[model samples]
Every structure is written in C-alpha cells, then in structure tokens.
Target: MRMALFSLVATVMALGASPAIAQEREQVKLVFEHALPNVEGKRMDAVLVSYPPGSKSLPHRHAASAFIYAYVLSGAIRSQVGNDPTQVYHAGEGFYETPGAHHRISENASDTEPASLLAVFVVDSKDGALTIPDKDATPK
Candidate 1:
C-alpha cells in the first residue's frame, strides 16, 4: 500500500512540474524596450520587438502613441529617422524616438546575420496595439 501511494505522489509531482517548464520556455526574447508618457491621465503601452537578420519593417508610426526607447541585440541594424542620416546600431546599443516623430526605417545591415530589437511604446493600456501611421512611405 505504501509503495502505491509513493508512486501516485511522484506522478502528481511530475505533472505539476510540466507546466512550470513550459512557462519557462515562453519567456520573452527581448531585443528592445521603451515606454511613453502619460496622456489624458493614462499611460501608453510599452513596446517590445524582436527580429532576425535580413528583416525590414514597413515605414510606420504610432498614432496616439510614441516610442520611448529602442535597443539592439545579438547583431547590427540600421535606422533612418526622418531626414536624418541613417545610423547603425550594434549589439547593446539603441536610440529613443521623439514624440510624434515619424516612425523610423529599420533594416538588418548584415545580409547573412541575425539581429534583434526591443521597443517600448506608450499607449492607452499596458497591452495595446501598436499603430503603424504611415505604411506607404518608402524606406531610405
């Protein structure tokens, strides 16, 4: 009888541990981080983004939201902010977006390598959709 009880306890423990293991695997792979200011007595949503090399996003902006900060991880990326010259960011480097500024253009600098980024956006809620303001603009 004692042996059967011990086996049941062991099985229960194994089942309980399975979910913890799966949760660990779901951890965010952060590449960038930023937060916006309070508007209308509310804080905007923070933004985070991750990408591999050779990845490029369409020209876009966050309406009623703004980028608080941007960070690069793992590899290098290039960003063009408005008419400013394009800048290259290596691992562990980043920049901030001005309020209402056009969402900058981003692209992987290395053709065969991978890169990542984390961007924090200040929106109405902690979990809000990121608005892409201008999708038609060409990448410079």
Candidate 2:
C-alpha cells in the first residue's frame, strides 16, 4: 500500500509538470516569401506564430537587417520588445519591431484561449533565419 501511494504521488507530480513544459513551446509556420523588385537587395517574408493556451516563445531577436510588423490575428498576445514595457494586443491590433530589436516577450495572454499572429518582415535578401534565440535566455 505504501509503494502504491508513492507511485500515485509521483504520477501526480509528473502530471503537474507537463503544462510548464508544454508552455515553453510555440508553433511557427512560414506563410509567404518574396523578393522585392523595386527595393534593391531586400526581401519580404511573412510567418505565422501560433501559441496554445498558456504557451510562450523563448526570448529572441530578429535578423540584424530585418524590420518586423506583427499583427494579432485571433485572441490576444502579450509582447515586449527591447527595453519597452510589456503590452497586450488584441485581435486587429498590431505593432512593429525595428531592425535588431530584442523580443523579450511573446506569448498568449489568456491561459484558456489560444492566440496567433502574423509577422511581416522586410530584411536583406541575404539574411538567414528570421528569429534567433538569445544566448542564455529561456521561455518566460
């Protein structure tokens, strides 16, 4: 009986930890990309970020040459860029991040409802990844 009780406690602890692990991850999909004919050596890319309830992305920065505009598509998102205070943006609201800005916060504002955003980036044609994780930084 004691062994069974210990097993039950362990199971409970494992279940409790699952949400935190799940919250540390988000889904990202590249929706569009195109090279600009008028703008020399520049390209435009659009990515969709989806956050499940309680989920968040790790701290990160964009390509040094990228300027980003983010629009909330559904639900609400909480975000903070560089040294700015955190802000919550609802559906139809949007914000921009200048080149080389650090994205300190990106997450769903609601614990029960999922959220999503579309990120439009104008970057140098040679730039690689759109987002780069910060060294020594973790999801909040």
RMSD of each: 14.0, 14.9
- TM-scores of all predicted structures: 0.60, 0.82
The runs of at least 3 residues in candidate 1 whose Cα sits more than 4 Å from the true structure, single-residue gaps closed, are 1-40, 126-128, 137-140
What value of lDDT does candidate 1 attain over all alpha carbons?
Answer: 0.53
> What C-alpha lDDT values do all the predictions have?
0.53, 0.80
RMSD of 2: 14.9
- Per-residue lDDT tens digits for candidate 2, residues 36-119, read 888999998877777888888999999999999887777799999999999999977899999989999898998888777778
Q: Which ten residues in a row are the worst by lDDT in model 2?
A: 12-21
Per-residue lDDT tens digits of candidate 1, residues 1-140? Answer: 34633443344334331112211011123222233243453453333343444566666666454545666645777888777888999877878787567656776676566555555545444534455547566544
- Give lDDT: candidate 2, residue 17: 18
What's the C-alpha lDDT at position 63 in model 1?
Answer: 48
